[model samples]
Target: MKLAIVGGGSTYTPELIDGFARLRDILPIGEIALIDPAEQRLELIAGLARRILARQGSPARVTTSTSVTSGVDGADAVLLQLRIGGQSARHRDETWPLECGCVGQETVGAGGLAKALRTVPVVLDIAEQVRASNPAAWLIDFTNPVGIVTRALQDAGHRAIGLCNVAIGFQRKFAAHLGVEPERIRLEHVGLNHLTWERGVTLLDEPDGESGREVLPELLDRFGERVAQDVRMPLTLLESLGVVPSYYLRYYYQHDAVVRELGARPSRAEEVAALERQLLALYANPSLNTKPELLAQRGGAFYSEAAVQLIAALLGTDGRSRTQVVTTRNDGILPQLPDAAVIEAPATVDAKGVRPLPQRPLPPLFAGLVAHVASYEELAVRAAVAGGRARVFDALLAHPLIGQLDLADQLTDRLIAHNHGYLSWA
Candidate 1:
């Protein structure tokens, strides 16, 4: 199979390459096209990718391209992982929001909205090119604000599926804590991307047929504190909610405190910017054939495994359906949101297509939050596709984090000002 990775210049590319090398038996990759405009960084990443494959004795042909059309041509699958305006833009996304007393996170709140506006247009353009090259090829999005991006792709009539590592990361953690294989632990992962909760932990040796021992209570009883620490939530809150919220929930459940903490520290974007520089230096070393340990701290843990599993199932390489967390159309999965709304939930994926499984009614607590965010996402997507200051302000006003008019107005101006170069309407 031929696979193309857009933004192959990113420091995160080697981790993906390592997964491709190790999982060749499951998903035999015959060729790799690394596409990036930054020719220097692209060469560094492609060199390490070739060396990693060579070390594994894999015969996959590695190629490089500075154009999306050339890189994705005739490829069976195209993976989108590009950043429109690199980490410097991310620094702005993470810091500017704190000035208005809001969470400065890239995947949630004001920062997430900024990323969606900047990313959606670029991703849509690339998707159009990928479709033009080979309409049959599947587009896998591993981008930020995945809910919005995936929604835009499906809206544009593109064959796309959104992937995130959060579910896999949770699965691995719960598996290690329970002394089971990660595959055996199926998460009852529900909600939108980056805004999900683990309501049930089912142990199933086979595919999720909606039948398994629900061990969430037991897992909490035995290892609640550790789980709380991992998610940065208080153990008492976990007991009260009777569910595990994504770590991103910290931004919502404790918005003011998070804003204070964000204001005090150098933004995460700053830390990652420095780390990427160091990682690029390492990638440039000809002797380096493996992903460095520091890459682990750079985040996106288990992303490669998640991407491989999703691709394998989608391409029928696994020869059977598998349940995995993905961002796809709601399709009435939750009665609270519109079917067109994109949500991150576990679904059965196979060659035929992805179908969201039926979900139990979300408790009022979770449902309210999910519905609120889903509404904001719809508006945010509209603003992203058809830009306007009023649209931006409306989306911000609808967000639970910035529902006040004054704050929304201020954030909208700042978002537009910081993102004017990318926003065509600005």
Candidate 2:
């Protein structure tokens, strides 16, 4: 069996590669290929992967190419973790739209839509290749605007899964609140990526209804303010529904009433600047190329796939055990909505491949928001690929925040004029 990691030379690639190398023993199978256009990044990462494999007492064949098709053909799986602007370009993508008075945040609002228009085609093209070349390969997505991109790929009939560290990562953060280890927790993650909240977690056998009755009440009463105070957490989903969540809680907190009541806001300007400075510094680091050991210390040397451990679970490596993933539609897994809804839900993994979790209805607000954004993203994908400004305008207007503002037409025009070549139809 073979695995292909498209955009294999990214900063995060080393992490994924290292993660995969770490899990390779359980997997104990075949070659892992890296697909990337930049020879420099690919060479550096390949060197590192071999070194990692050697250290792990295993010899994993590492190969790469500039061509997407060559990298993906006949591969058993493709794990995608692509960035549109690379590290440096993200600053402009994040800051420019905010400067224009658009939602200004990354991966959710105006900025996300703009980024989506630029990315959909590349992702779509690659998906088409993967489907045609190796129809059985699972497409694991770690792409941003994940809900939007994942939805589009499935609508076009590609085999794919969206992975967010959010589910596990969030579980860990909130575990701090509950006083437990994340690995020991079992939870149901619902809603869109990045926006997802834990509807439920069972730890120490915290019976569903029991924890629902006890822990949430305690969280809301005791540490609710503490959780919301960070400005990176999204406690609104928790408070609105009375369940705790993980990942990026602070920003969501600002979006919620609790923050307003407390007169709190995440320092957006400062936050954006700090992120920009960090990314800039990362690009400027010289040891990034010549010194693998030192660069490894920086944590960028671990080129990796999105779900090696999960893949190990599917392959049943080292008894890692299978898991349930909430992603895309295969059948009537979700009862009410079209299998086409691209709803996130629990799934099972095995040596054969990754399969969808049977779907359940999300909370009304969460469902509606995910549906609306996904629908508009599809519309925007069509517009971007076909060069239709009106459709693009309508797509932007259809977004929750943009739709609410009534500035779609003007904002559309301004952004089109400003972004120019960047937004095709605009």
Candidate 3:
């Protein structure tokens, strides 16, 4: 089989590369391709990927391409790790929403919509290229604004999987909270990308094995404080939910939640600069190992992500295990959202491909929490694929931040302008 990374120069490439290299023992061998527009960074990351492969003495082919068509042609899997306009654009994405009196945050409310508008077309073009070049390729997207872009691809009828490592990551935290081995815990959850839930959990082998037996103590105040200030964001949401969430939370904390929390909002520019400086500096720093170490380090974090490993565990050679997955479809899963809306949950995968677990009703707390966000995600998908002002307006109004402003019309005008060229409005 073959594997390709669409935005190969990504700062996170090494994590996945390192991840796959270690998996050589379990999965079949294959060639790998790296595609990126940033020539220097692409070459650097490619070189690192190759060196790592060579060091491990793995026979996986490593090729570099400036074009997605060439990179993904005839591939088994395509990993999309794209960040359009890089740091410069992300700064605007993070800062603008707050200026408009909306909770300016990343990957959730208005901030994400702005990013989604600019990102959808580029990602759609990439999806089209993947479809044309390799019809059977499964696009494993790890991009941010993941919910929006993935929905666009699904709406356009492309084969893709929006994989987030959050589930397993949170499972570990929850397991710790409940004093159980992470692996033994079984779960069911539903929500958008970074924002999610822990509806239930159980020991795999225990009798009368239900959640009522496990007692969860309180940690919200402490957890909330930890997540709110740190740049490693996502911790705050975990604290907020009374579960330790995965990913960074500093960006998520500055939103309307600031008002919800203490009525004090920090400077937006300061928030944007945190990640901006890190990525720009990483790119600037010459220490980025462009040698064999790159591949060695690539994908080092996947053990925890468990998306591919979970698929492998359930479907590959030792086939039979299963888990929850996020799937798009308004269907029986969530009564509030449309039947075609994409929802995240546990799934089963094997040689037969993926099957969404039977739809489980979301709890009132989480259901009410994510309802508007889910609406934004669904509407954003329509805006990207259908490209009408109505869809854009719907997406804008559907967001918690925008709705809080009660100026959906104004927010809609601004968002449309922010993402003006990313769509095909008539």
Candidate 4:
């Protein structure tokens, strides 16, 4: 199989290379094309990718390119990981929203809407090129504002699926606490992209074998402190909700506190920018083939595994009806949201494509929030595709985080002014 990574120059590429080398048996990739406009970074990362493959004694050949058309041509799967304006733009997204007293996140609040407006057009253009190159090739998106981006691609009639590592990260953590392999844990993760919860964690491959022994409560009881700390939520909240919220939920569950906290610390984008510099220097080392430990700090934990597994399943290399969490169009999976909205949930993946598993209706508390966010996502997509200040304002107004008309107006103006270059239609 030939796989192309769009943002192959990113510091996170090495972690993906490591996964490809280690999990070769699962996907058996024959070639990898690293596609990026940053030639120097791409060359450095490509060298490391080759070295890692060689050290693992894998026959997969690694290549680098600045042309998406040439790089993705004939590839079996194309992975989207590009950031529209890099971390510098992300810093703006993270910092500017706080000025409006809204959560300064890249994929949730006004900032996320800003990112979507900047990102969707570029992603669609790339998807068009991929289709022209290889109509059969699957598009695996790991881009931010995934729920919105994925919906755009699907609506445009592209074969695409969005991926996030949150569920896998949770699974790994839960597995460790249960003293079991990660594969044995099955998470009933449900919601739209960043707004999700692990309602149930069943032991799938264990002796109990699909008996549906939910371990979420046990995990909360035994490892509540650790989990709570990681998510930055009060343990009591978990006890009260009876479900573990995704770390992204912190911006919502504790909005005022998060605003205060964000005001006090440097934005996450700043920290990642510094870390990326260190990672690039390490990648330039000729002797360094294995991924540096610092790469873990770069985030997207287990991303490579999720991508490989999903790609394998999509191509029918893995015949098992693997229940994996992914973002795809909602075809009545939620029953509460529009069928066109993209949602993140556990789905059975195979050669036919992803099929979202039936889920119990979300409780009113969670349903209301999911529906509210889904409305924002819908408007965000429209605003992104059909660029107009009014569309942008309406989307912001619909967002639960920025419902006030005046605040919505402020956010819309800031978003357009900051991202005007990327919004050609505006």
Q: Per-residue lDDT tens digits of candidate 4, residues 209-316?
A: 565577788899999999898788999999999999999888888898998898889999999999999988888899997999999899999999998889889998
- The TM-score of candidate 3 is 0.79
For 1-426, candidate 1 gives per-residue lDDT tens digits of 899999988999999999998998878999999999999889999999999999988889799999999999989999999788889999999999988998998879899999999999899999999988899999999988888999999989999999998899999999899898887899889999989999999987654455579899999999999999999989999999999999999988988988998899898888999999899899889999989999998999999998988899999997988888999999899998998999989898999989998999999999999999999999999999999999999999999999999999999999999999999989
Q: Write the per-residue lDDT of candidate 3 for residues 257-368, one digit (tens) a residue.
A: 5534322554443544464345545545444533233332333244324645543543354555456455444456678777656667776666566666775676676677
lDDT of 2 at 339: 57
In model 1, what lDDT does residue 282 have?
Answer: 94
- Model 1, global lDDT: 0.92
Worst ten-residue run, lDDT, model 2?
297-306
What lDDT score is found at residue 41 in candidate 3?
80
Worst 10 residues of 4 by lDDT: 204-213
In candidate 2, what are the lDDT values of residues 56-96, reduced to their tens digit?
66566889988988899888778877766564344444455
Candidate 2: residue 220 Cα off by (Å) = 5.4
Which segments of candidate 4 are over 4 A away from where they belong? 205-209
Show model 3 residue runs off by greater than 4 Å.
175-181, 205-304, 310-321, 327-330, 388-390, 404-406, 421-426
How are the candidates ranked when ordered by lDDT, highest leading? 1, 4, 3, 2
Steric overlap count per candidate: 0, 27, 34, 0
